[model samples]
Target: MRSQENGPIKIDGIDKMILNAFMENANIPVSQLAKDLGISNTAVHQRIKKLETSGVIDSTKVIVNPTVLGYSTMSFVGVFMNKPSSYKLVLNSLEEIPEVIEAHFTTGNYGIFLKILCRDNLHLMNVLNQKIQQIEGVTRTETIISLEQPIVRQIKL
Candidate 1:
């Protein structure tokens, strides 16, 4: 079926429950999910397949601990760009960098803001000087280095 332009996909109660279960653990097996939801494994598998085909469920991935990898410095940089009009063109450009974790457009003095994860001062400096500043319209930036983050998990259904 053809989907409408710019509207959220309608999710029924059953689908919502299935999605919530999967969100908690993307690598969950169909049998376990079926057992937990009190449904047949076949039903769970079909629903997951449907969601994937419809573009609602993207690829599953493993979430890793950055601290365990010895990447301790976490910084949020709010960059003010001179060229404020090119958001879409610039957003993709920012995502190309490996260090940039999140880039958001907000209503503030800054045109673009990014959350960057770096190994140390040298890494962070390289990201700023070579990577970020190279982007057009990035006039000024204010970086807030996080000493410690209380939480960094997504809150879902």
Candidate 2:
């Protein structure tokens, strides 16, 4: 089931249907899923278990509303490292900042890109100045604040 080349996992039709249903609602009851799919509850449960064990289903978590939680500012930071050898150090430093929600090693102008969530502009500034800039290898950063997110959804199956 694991691929060294990061290839797609082998999934049949039923697995696709099951994945689509779960993606629509992760909290859906297994019995209801089974009924809707015209399959036994035990069969559905076994399939789900297999999917989880095989790393097909990584995790099921509640998606919290960041706005409701007072995280109003979403910003992306493009990190420029001093040298290639500094990547690991910069990544370790980035992880210590709680505001950093996501980080990716990219292929373009920036060595690393980060998605940060903050309560306000001031919070974002503090994170950039006091936290991110403190990392030795991080020579500079370019940030763009998100005004709105019109579309956000998982990929089609």
Candidate 3:
């Protein structure tokens, strides 16, 4: 429960234990979790349901390995637009491109930032020159290819 209006929700030690366990393995069985936590299966289920209702748990997802599908190159792109009003249209256009895995309306030199995946440098160039640059409002783009990603994890509970 939240202590104040629109404030962060308050959770106990047991709640933290449950969240940490689930964070390690979302597919962990409820029975196993209950046994590890020394609580009943019903208790674990109730806590998870409560966490979901309180908006702490958004949704479970299957993380995919892009390399297995031949998407080896990962690049971050900073996109500049002709005008701020073109944001919505540009966003809608970006949504249609499957290579654009993530997009952000950020506070910096670029009006928008994108994380894209492709097979190689050539594929990245084609995506940038042919698709992204062709957007009506897109004026320019700056791209940086990732050589290695050492850290990728959620926030500490």
Leading candidate by lDDT:
3
Error of 1 at 88 (Å): 5.9
**What would you estimate as the lDDT of candidate 1?**
0.82
The candidate, 1 or 2, that scores higher on lDDT is 2
List candidate 3 stretches off by more than 4 Å.
3-5
Each prediction's whole-model lDDT (CA): 0.82, 0.92, 0.93
The candidate 2 region of ten consecutive residues with least summed lDDT is 1-10
lDDT of 2 by residue, 1-157 (tens): 4542677777778888899999998988999999989999999999898889888899999999999999999999999999989999999989989999999999999999999999999999999999998899999999999999999887767
Q: Mind giving the per-residue lDDT tens digits that candidate 3 earns over 1-157?
A: 6634679989888889888888888999999999999999999999999888888888888989999989999999999999999999999999999999999999989999999999999999999999999999999999999998999887767
Model 3 weakest lDDT span, ten residues long: 1-10
Error of 2 at 95 (Å): 0.5
- lDDT value, residue 146 of candidate 2: 99
Q: TM-score of predicted model 1? A: 0.82
- Give the poorly placed runs of model 1, Cα more than 4 Å off: 1-6, 86-93
List of clashing residue pairs for candidate 2: none
* TM-scores of all candidate predictions against the true structure: 0.82, 0.94, 0.95
By TM-score: ranked, best first: 3, 2, 1
